[model samples]
Target: MTVPEKRLHEDGDGDGDGSGANDTTALEEKRQNTQPYIKGIAGIKPEFLAPISSLSSTYTEYNDDEAEGGDRDKNGSQNGNGDKRRKKERGQNQKRDLKQKRDTVRLCVSLIDPEDESTPCVAGDEEKCKYSHNLEEYLASKPKDIDGMCPVFEALGYCPTGMKCRWLHSHFNKETKKLIKDLGKLETEKDKSFEVNLIDRESKIALQRKKYKYEISEQVIKYLDSKVQRNDSHQENRKENEATYVEQPFKIAEKKKIDLRGAKIVSPLTTVGNLPFRRLMKTLGADVTYSEMALSVPLIQGHQPEWALPKAHISEHPGFGVQIASSKHWAAAKAAEVIYRTTQHVSELNLNCGCPIDLLYKSGQGSALLDQTPRLLRIVKAMNGSSGDIPVTIKIRTGVKENKNTAAHLVDRVLNETQVAAITLHGRSRQQRYTKEADWDYIEEVGKVVKNWNEKREEDKEGRDTNPTWFVGNGDVYTYEDWYNGVAREGVDSVMVARGALIKPWLFEEVEAQQYLDKSSSERLSMLDKFAKFAIEHWGSDEYGVNSARRFMCEFLSFTHRYIPVGIMERLPPKLNERSPKFVGRNEMETLLSSSDYKDWIKITEMFLGKAGEDFQFVPKHKSNAYENTENR
Candidate 1:
């Protein structure tokens, strides 16, 4: 398979005139200086083979100089200028703003439902209502209907967004002036409950008014206060007699046990792991999924935005886990109690002790818990005592710094101190971040320790309530080989995938097949289309919803665009650390899919959602093209 030559930009702006002719003699001269060849092996689908005329608008031209060591310095800053480039933001954006203002006005909530027209203002009289109830005025100033069928209405038999839907024309009766619904389909499809973990209006109001009771959490906290010594150093060992004497306020109920021996689990990702993405993963073949890590403080305070993190699709149940981060025992206890009381779909409640972001670590949460083992154990104990039958799990890293691995040493303490159901080790220190490869050898050692501890408990004939903790390893499991190798180890039960799943959602499918399947460009596009539809269904079909879906879709593409196709690789399996050399695809669509430019990502989103507004803009969280010096921090 011959590879195409890298196309050069004719101008400095990185946008060149559309041209196809190649100078063979000049290409041959430049071939010796280029990197290894990578070609597109799969055949292109006819429907996705776009015309060259459209390519100019859809594709961002790569600058020839930038691809071949241009004027930029090693720090990715421009040269020959006294002005220095602004350093890119790292970790979480403290000023992250997602408030999307719509270009046009919207109708009042009271007027949205055609069936409930009698109660124009349920909160009060219609004259006192603050929202605009003028339907005629709203329709007149509403943005033009988007050009496609409403994906939510098409699948669910009805659109919940009602008249506010951008695709209003698709399911609206202009003559009757009523939103349409497929009664027959609704009756046939029995389960209308698509999502779970939603706090009711009364519960939310109660929380806001500080009227909701935390009876279980209060009891647990009071008991802990009576027994635990404040200001005690974590290094000081507790007296052996103290362990047998101190009892919890009440006996912990028998919880549902989870066995992750061979399960393929998706890690609790932050921004990208939303409900729509998890639903897409479930369809692809993931056995387990986790919600984005919710902060315990906000959850206990009844903040609606934080509450949205725990909402899960119906298909995710029986394997779904809700993860929460807290620095204090009270917050963890109260949050766990509330989640247990309100949610029926959760299989486990996971405490996050592995998040390495500066914002979390500085706040005495996440990896900071590694240093404060006493506080961490107290938080875990409080959660276990409060969250009735739901299993409790925790995700931790090696330690806080390099060359000081503490996870193996902390294993015995965790086993003896808390009744956690499972332990997931991420195999990297908080300081290590992604600078170096994950230390799986250390993870295996920790796994062995956990396995031995469980065996010793079994041999000692511990009480029936004493459950054996499952050990799962995470980090850098990108392929089927990685999955098999991890599971085949002596003590590791399963693997939890993060960036790998984001790059290839069909990773579980490959694990089942036990071989690499070279996906075509068209197939990948189809996957994106499915995600788009799911996002629309989950977010809504309004202008704001469409843009929200588009923003997230772009985020998904940011990670996926790094995937180097199996067919093109000179080697068998790709390494997470290795970078791909500059290469063009056999076809234009395939080339477009491989683009790292955010502009190109926006162009891809436009393929599903209509053309973005002039004001629509996206700045990726990380600079994918920035050079990394592995030797340094």
Candidate 2:
């Protein structure tokens, strides 16, 4: 109600009598005017007042003009009807804003990006994700991260957007034109030997034909029993005969070690894994290391180079892991068989389904494996058949995107479909690539689901085995303290490190020591030396090798540089450009030997490549900026 009018009426003075209301207003005005003078006596400014909204409400009934008052020029100086017109204009503007939001935001989406794009669209788009290709190769060739996802071929309209097709980019580009652009040279300097053509209808048809021939042949080969070779039809089919072969289930070994107070991490980055690297990690006190990812098709083909990736070093004895990427049952089975035969060093066999790289995702491998659960079951079952004493594992992201986490679904599948050794989860969706946080909460949620699943599995006649697949978490773990925080939680088993380890090899050691061992610059230089020796053995010590080794060293250094933690460096706040903590003397060399850096890495590579070898050329991988979501978040 209008305070003054209500006051007049409440005082038995009718509003019809303008005299009484005016008198009350005059009295209120006099009181307000005297407030400043009274404040001077008390030395207090009249700071407290009734809320404007409430005061305005009380005054509301006094006059309709007051109701329309706020609507007038907000300057509070406008005449009555002016407010009404302004109110109308405000409503119109609000309506317009809403309409704009509806039209533009219906299908808006934010996607995770890779660190590099020049190699392959592991998840689909390159530009959206800032991820580069493989770093080792990038350092070797260009010493720089490139600007594209895939180099050999670019598909037209091949984005993995599915139904959310925005059709925003050029479907194809001429190879020659792109080459000129990439070389950063003028067209006059372009080589004419190779031709580039956009993917047209004719080209697509030819591509389809090639795919049909390849895929159909592969499918047929996989369908045939191993013992059913045409030339050996007359021979005894030992593997295929009913008496010789039977569908069996996976068996999980009891936990050999009792320590369960840590994070269980798994890596989907098998391609970059190698014996030298895994061994180095083990030496560094890492809890575990995954084998480079293996492909089911190549294993079925018995390709020598492909099979070589699964090979374990003599030092990879206890915690070695073998990870495979596959979308078919027989292929998975075949790959597992090859891994087991080549490496007794493995404790776990991981299936990759979190990789968003277009090569793996588009082929129904990696994250694509999440879609065909029944198929995944079949594949895992095949692995179980020949798992032997080793455990079977799986690596995956949360889901495709849009807040969907398939861990709950896949957790159940892993529990019921096949006997798995463990599940390693990278928290971001496959669509996120390495652009966001690793999603620890979701990882915990998955952990809970797995725990619940185990209880149910134990109760079921079919899933009577008490051995549940262990839960392993990965993504963006940088510090030892972060590692402890993650695994020390109830839901986690053990954590895995990728880029963190690459950047700081001494992380595990630091955690084990329970104190920071900040290495000096000279000490870091020494670590690079050891890495060089390892690289030499892997790449050979020739000129063709040395240059390549130098390049990869730089790559390793790039990651290593990120590890200089804040506390140890006596130099207050640490900056990448600032000097790292120096050892008291040269005595800190051992600590430095445990670290990494591109410069030291190259120095190390020099030992192997003869100091003259050129670096391998390719793309760089991206580190996710979504630290809060995937790791810290």
User: Quick one: best TM-score, which candidate?
Assistant: 1
lDDT of prediction 2:
0.47
Q: Pick by lDDT: which candidate is best?
A: 1
Candidates' TM-scores? 0.83, 0.53
RMSD of 2: 24.4
RMSD to native, candidate 1? 9.5
Report the lDDT of model 2 for residue 75.
39
lDDT of 1 by residue, 1-633 (tens): 112222232112111222323322222323443523222111122233334343322322221111111111234422112234322322212233445667366566777766765646754766777666788887777677878888888887788788788789998999999889998776665364388889888887888888889878998887775556734563244343246447654877789989888898999887788899999999999989999888898898889988999999988989999999999998999999999998899999999898766556668888889888988899999999999999999999999888799998777798987889999999888776654668889999999999998888888855434877999999878888788878777689899988789888889999888878788889999999999998998888878888899889987887787777776654545655444434456577777787676677877898888777765645554444232323321
Candidate 2 runs further than 4 Å off: 1-272, 456-466, 545-548, 565-610, 613-633
1-633 per-residue lDDT for model 2 (tens digits): 001111111111112222334433433443365422210011111222223332211111111111111121123322222355743432211111101011111221222112123435544664554444342232243222212332111221122221122111122233321211222332332331121111234423433343312322233224334323344554565444534435322233343331323633324333334455565666677666666666777655655555566666555545566667787666676555545544455677777776665556667887777777766776776676554556777777788763777777877767765576678787777655444456788888888877777677788897774565577777656556557656754457778776666656777876676545666655565666566545544543333333444555554544564444433332221211121211222234333332322233334443333332232331222111001222210
